[model samples]
Target: MQRYLEGELGEEQFRPLRLQNGLYIQRKAPMLRIAVPYGLLSSQQLRKLASLTRDYDKGYAHVSTRQNFQLNWPELERVPDLLGELAEVDMHCIQTSGNCIRNTTTDQFAGVSPDEVVDPRPYCELIRQWSTLHPEFAFLPRKFKIAVCGSQSDRAAIYSHDIGLALQHDRQGNLGVQVLVGGGLGRTPVIGSEIESWLDIKHLLSYLEAVLRVYNQLGRRDNKYKARIKILVRAMGVDKFREAVHREWSKLKDGDNTLTEKRIEDVRAHFRAMPYEQLDATAEAALLAQHDDPIFKNWLKRNTRGHKVAGYRAVTVALKHRDLAPGDITADQLDHLAELADRFSFSEARTTHHQNMVLADVRERDLHDLWTALQKANLATANAGYLTDMICCPGGDFCSLANAKSIPVSDAIRDRFDDLDYLYDLGPIELNISGCMNACGHHHIGHIGILGVDKKGKEFFQVSLGGRQAESPKIGKILGPSFGASEIPEVIAKILERYVELRQEDELFIDTIHRVGIEPFKERVYG
Candidate 1:
């Protein structure tokens, strides 16, 4: 700290150091990102975050795409005090940014997803402990992201991360992980490639360490833009990267990091099964009410998702209300959410990468009352996975790296397509808007991506199509030419109109594009 004040450290050296502690000097104020490992938050931890936001910031915090909470405004000097407070809640902003092993993210419905192959939270928790303040890989070539998923569906969007771990079982029923490397979505977005189809859990940690060691040693550091592991993997190709990792792993095999059955069991014990209520004859009433009430049916269709526990459902509380920014939640609303989570979700809540919160253990019988409570609190808009449930960055409005305002574009799209029935017809279209090429909004993976660009110092938006963040993830393709800020919504409408006309019956927006290809859509838009 003294060396930094004495001008001994340059901006390049000090900037990354500060970012490692989650402190960023934004255009207007300093922003601090609080790590929420695996997106798990107890009611008490959430209340503490609420208090910190109210005291240090503008009474709100933004949930980021990495499943962390970001406080936008704080005095740089006072950041330590807030971090100290967060430490009291067993939380700290460590390795959230910078070239370090960042917070490990997982499926919001990790343990409880109906299609889960394994309970991934325990594994994620173990990784969180193993990597926290890890001495060796603290300052690597560039920032790294790792996501774990246990479900049949890729809710964690692991393919878009630097290291994606999808838990799987071999033919002999032994548990292992399918390892992927090189995936990212910044200036150069690329979906990760599989390096190991199924690595035994005992050797997984060592293999991961080997990969990181290889990347740390060989990844480009001279050019920050090309420093990411994705760049390295692309340059070397997946086969060569795999061989390097294999060579390194052979040296480290059966070393200290090798997993033991006792360690796995110990961590699993912490995540013991939730107390689930047995479904009685009353379960029939909940299903019947959906048929009778159109609003309830719509809400059920969008907000409530399947849970492994038969009598329960995972409920997504929409934070994309038109009145608020996509990821912003007021301190008061957070307090209320904590209270509601205590009552409904066993004192727990989880945040999604798409800026939504989930109550993962809500019983079906309590849906009506919970929905009513949510309605009063403005958390029950029922727009999960819809066109209006957009992923937006705090563009030129707050971020210094942004080219133009992104929230306004998100707001405009919401307003233009406000009809609920119309949104349902579109069917799970991901409309992500990034402020700049940084891809903070994950625009590269959206079905319909909008990037904020500057043309002669004027705000212009570039559009992309057919990108996805699933098992077979693909980067979006540009639609040629940029549009004025005011012209974006109309442009989106035209594309949607073309999609509606070209799509086969009940085909999804992305599926239709895959079948028809980008050229046809490009012709319709530019024709």
Candidate 2:
């Protein structure tokens, strides 16, 4: 029996006992989650993590939804030792695998986002320390996730996190956060219902503690699958939940744990902004003249986003593979990206939830050279946010939890729709694929949702339509019956062809679907 976790073992037989068949007895594996503060990491940190994975654990590390790295290896006995190594480099695996306070996540575009009111790094670092090794909330009913976004674009995907905090200012000009609770994904995915419209930053940690306490006491522990705080929030109405959280919050407010100005300043010191130089004009013109190719132009248009800087852009190296495994970057590919970040982007790389690597703070004119280098590295897939850029899980291929294989399905869809212009014409479509009912790929919120299911002995896919992820969040609706793997591409093609035919000029797929209704799409595809 796995008894050491419950404090029932001598230190001698530790490593061999804690991990039985790679299952760490909690969730799945003895996963080591490493924080990449604000999704920004030095190339050195990335290389070290890569080496750590290659040396200590599995050859691969999974980039989590919360912008952290989770390595699936090492013995539970060696966890303390692993923590010690991580601490040597100012990293830790504490609260990464437990029901206790987990790592706090923030927007990938924390500092550089053009739309941000202020950098959320200070807030994230402050909350991170408060949550780390929090004693009273160690044993909870279920896992909890928190995300903070300073951008209107919601780069952190705050709408779908367990506790989503959006930094905003009130009319009178005071900094505050708009908080959302209970949004989560798993067996049942839900957009978190809003609880607090505006709560000042000083009360952030205490308010969060109150909410967690309410959930810890009320959340269901009997059914592991139904134990998420979202279920609890839903079962007890939102208003009642808010009332309960307020009741708990009133007790914890301003009692020695109030966010002090000095404490905030201490955390801020650790996150001093990276040094940046003024853009060079001569370098910009030389870059443009060097690579005026059509492909490079498309890469420039789709892959690069506006940076807060005058002459720089944030480059997204999209891993939303046409048919390949999402978030699967080879070791060689990793090295190449690191080099690119060092040379072109100001020594920082960001890992996005869309499973893309971002080279933040790149000069606009140097885009062509960057593309040429990326092409060599196979990171130049000019489909950043397009339909071919499908967000897919390993499904049956790697994940033991999947009901069907998602890779092949994504591949089939990509192969059938190979024309880039046709994809561009379709415009701003989100196609998310999941192998099972568990929404790891976030199929529920995709413009075109594909869920792999088992019907009798054969695998099939069920399609959904009209979902979107911009400011106005809407869940997609199921289109119709399940189709065989072979039939998926044809069905998708039929739906898209119908969309192109019916859409007004410049109408996106999501807009066209919403304007024309799903019945037209369903009839065309199923007919």
- Please write out the lDDT profile of model 2 over residues 1-527, one tens digit for every residue: 24666667765565333321122332344555676655667777667676676666766666655566766555666666665666666765556554665567776667887898878888987777777667777767877878888877776777777899989999999889999998877677788889999998789889998999899999898998888899999999899999999999999998766787787778778666567668765676566667768888888888887778767778888765542466667556667777888888767788877767788778877787788899997889888888888888767765666778888988888888788887777787888899988777888888999998988867889899987655776778899999998999998889888998898988888898888889999899877
- Which lDDT value does model 2 have at 341? 82
Error of 2 at 456 (Å): 3.0
RMSD of each: 1.9, 3.8
Enumerate clash totals for all models, in the order shown: 0, 0
**Candidate 1 residue spans exceeding 4 A from truth:** 1-14, 281-292
Colliding pairs, model 1: none
Best by TM-score: 1
